[model samples]
Target: MMLYKLRLTFVLIAIGLNIGVQAQDFIPILKKRAYLNNSYQKLLKVTDTLKIAFIGGSITETNKGWRDQTMQWFASKYPNAKFKQINAGLSGTGSSLGVYRIDEHVLNHQPDLVFIEFAVNDYKASKHHILEAFEGMVLKIKKANPKTDICFIYTFSEAMLESYEKGFYPNSIIAMEEIASHYNISSVNFAPDIIQRIKNKTLAVIGPKQHPDSTYFSSDGVHPYENTGHLYYTQTLTKALDKLLNKGKRFNSKKDIYYSAQLEKAKMTHLETQMFNGIKAEIPPPKFSSLIQNIFALNQVEDLLQIQFKGDRIGFMDIIGPSSGTLKIKIDDQEPQYITRFDRFCSYERLHWFIIDGLAPDIQHSISISLAPNRIDKARILGKATDTEDYKKETWRVGKILMVDK
Candidate 1:
């Protein structure tokens, strides 16, 4: 029977090896904490609709990308549960713009979970602005609903791949990590795995033009290809979620109950009573001037928006798009100056804010803006303009007025 025992041992060993390989599928979290307790509880119940919101730049906004795939995976994973997904992704925008838009775009929907991706877009912003803006978003979300879960997602640009290879995140991501740690929020970073794949020659950072194999991340270094790169991103995120929700420690004990009660009390006291009012009363020390709490739509050339305020600076936030036209602005009877709303990147509509600083402070200043009657040279502005005909019917849509106190 020694031969029979030997065969049984080999079978058991093969089974053990298979189990070990399956176990390695999840990327290690190490010390990074992503409880995801609130959403986990909701998924377990499978009773109510779970609303998930994604807010970022073009990466999150792309069709059939990680955002869509993740939503589909969630639906399939929890077939009994109802799910609602909110897409608040805007192209060429960062956290500074995100905080302003969150109230109307995200918080209004009241999502159960929010996935924030802005590392690549916010790369150019100062570390201080990144911190302020990201923290502002967290505070605003928590203030709106304490139970809502938030996850910070960090995606990469080709320029960033070198940094990841050298064993570090870009500066913007570092700032975001600080905010995430401070708030006890979780984050999913796709950089390490993607970088590893690139190193192994399995995944190309650029396209087939650069690499021999057709497998690639993106044509442009910034946005990932919907099929290959986005699939990798979705796989990494879903696997992390599986590990975090299924194997990670959850908050379901007496001690956790007490902790949750205290946390809610603290949030109510500090966020509702103090922080929320502070945000409304005073603008955060801005990189530029702060946005005014109003939106005006200037649809026609005759349409005008005028505001009188005491501040050192003045500006307006507008929806910039292919059809956006120039505006004529007059400050306190001064000669009117023309400003074009369209730019090289205005192929699509996006919320854009500008500031005219160094204005006279302490005294009330009158500023009026009306659509200009001038026809802009699309060929000159856009360089090989695709929609020259559309540019003929230009419209102006302004969002908020920006100002800074003396």
Candidate 2:
């Protein structure tokens, strides 16, 4: 009996130690907990369909990656809930273009929760642009539906590894965090945990070609391999979700009571409780108080789109597909310049934008964008001699026109 008791105690100790090590592996991924009450209520209590949207660059767009994995996990976790997943991810595009396209692709769906990842793509962008575009997206979503929950997701890249190793987020992520803080949104940063794993020699930043014996994260150090790196990302996300959901439970229990008490207190003083009562007001105007006048959606443009406007800066957004051709833009009598909609990235369809600034804002300017007739040198543009047949179709699809007045 004494030997059996000692054996049982040893087994219990072993189990406890193993559990502790497992718990340590789940590093905290949640950066903030702002207001997810509406999402919580809708996801847990409401029987109506739950809509979750993900918008980002290639990382979120790739198949069988973190995005899809998390969706599957959500379905499994909430077996009774009907989920509508909206994937608005476009490869090689940053928040600059995302802000312009969100309405047509994501907001129209009226998603209850949105996951936005752009850190890697926006790495090279100016801080000012990142701030304006990311905030614009946040404001647009809230304007469309105040109850919508927005979460910023930061993925990794080779260039970002150094910053993460130095215990700092990349500049783009820091700028985005400012917006998240102001708007009370949550963010999940995978960099810290990923860097730690790399440092521990457990997660390889590059594939076997670079590190044969190590478990690799990605081939290019940007896009995670579907199985290995994506699995880590998915695990981080689900762990964060678990923590958020637990907090939501506590919030759900007391939120109604807390709000009711505030309402009663407001009524006693004859004060308006609309703000406290969660009655959403009219959608607020665009928060961009800067030079950006407005973004006008031109939709699909096959041949030509000519417009007149007064603006110091001008740009346009379009889809770059296999068949996408170049655009000839003539602005206010200037020499017509040719901009190719097809690039090395055009092998697959993705969003691309071009901007021309430093023009005089005083005078009314006219801009005509028409399909270029000249045949492009695909071999020169793509840096390859094969698979240039797609350029033959000469397709042009313009999505939006961006105008900024001084």
Candidate 3:
């Protein structure tokens, strides 16, 4: 009887070891030698309260997602410490918008620790833009509170696994790592770990069964399901945190200055309305689904929202739904540029940025935007869809204007 019990225990231990080995086989422990020791020290010796903020896309935006899980872990680990967790995550937004709104959405609350996640969403942006936005966020946070600690976390989707399998880092991750290296900060990457599991055939990118019901890490290869994908992300983050705590090393700050002209201008710029077409039009919210808060609705073409502001860079965010239209944008005597928001791949309310950069930093600039006439039929078709609802007739809507001045 005793032998039988020992045998069962050994089997369980073996199974656990095998699973761990497979899960960690290809995972890169950390992007650099530096870890979040600054934040760890703060956590270990908190007198009053520690406020943490997470900035990311939909994955980190889920209510009980990894962000919440990490918060719970903190609560459990430090029972006496008061913790205030702020979720500044907006779905379908990359770091470009993040840099523009960090002051309003995150920095105002004054967070001691900030976790940034845009690996999945920033893929489409140019490397220069990604670097500028990422560096801007880090610099702004650290400048506001020198003691604040920031960490970059890379989240994966079905599209990114192939690159990891080939032992190459994705472009987004590479761009962020450059900033992380320059800032002497640390980054957590899960691509190798996930690829290991996929290679071992223990996990499927997409669930086999469909229609009635299905089991998958992600429903559509991008956003993870509420349970499975989020759990994996939480597990990865917690493990990294545990290691960071145990390392007992402090970050080496070189006191390097990271600066961008656009970022500096953005610090004191506002996008106020200088003029309108003198019409009050109630814009309906874009039909594209999203988890982001504060979306302005526009439903009429005749309703023109004209604004004039003094800034070097000026832009606005709008939805590109199935029935999305085009906008005629003119910046300070420049030729009017027509921007079409519709495409065959249009499904979600994507956040789009239209800005003219490199203008006289301190000069006052005026811009105008209005819906282009006869735009519905001219939209390029990229895919096929079926719907009883007239999703093709919805008007374009802008959320808010972003401006940056010297």
* lDDT score, candidate 2, position 104: 63
Any runs in candidate 1 off by more than 4 Å, and if so which? 1-31, 208-212, 246-303, 309-317, 325-339, 347-351, 355-366, 371-378, 385-387, 392-395, 399-406
lDDT for 374 in candidate 2 is 76
RMSD of each: 12.6, 14.5, 8.7
Say which prediction, candidate 1 or candidate 2, comes out ahead on TM-score. Answer: 2
Per-residue lDDT over 49-132 for candidate 2, one digit per residue giving the tens place of the 0 to 100 score: 878999999899888999999999988998888889898887788987777668767887899899999999999888777887
Candidate 2 clashing pairs? none
| TM-score between model 2 and native | 0.72
Which candidate, 1 or 3, has the higher TM-score? 3
Off by over 4 Å in 2: 1-28, 208-212, 246-304, 310-314, 321-326, 347-349, 357-364, 371-377, 386-406
Across residues 34-136, which tens digit of lDDT does each residue of candidate 1 receive? 5776787778886778899999998998889999999999999989888898988877878766765677678889998899999999887877667866876
Clashing pairs in 3: 274-308, 283-297, 283-298, 283-299, 344-382, 344-383
Best by TM-score: 3
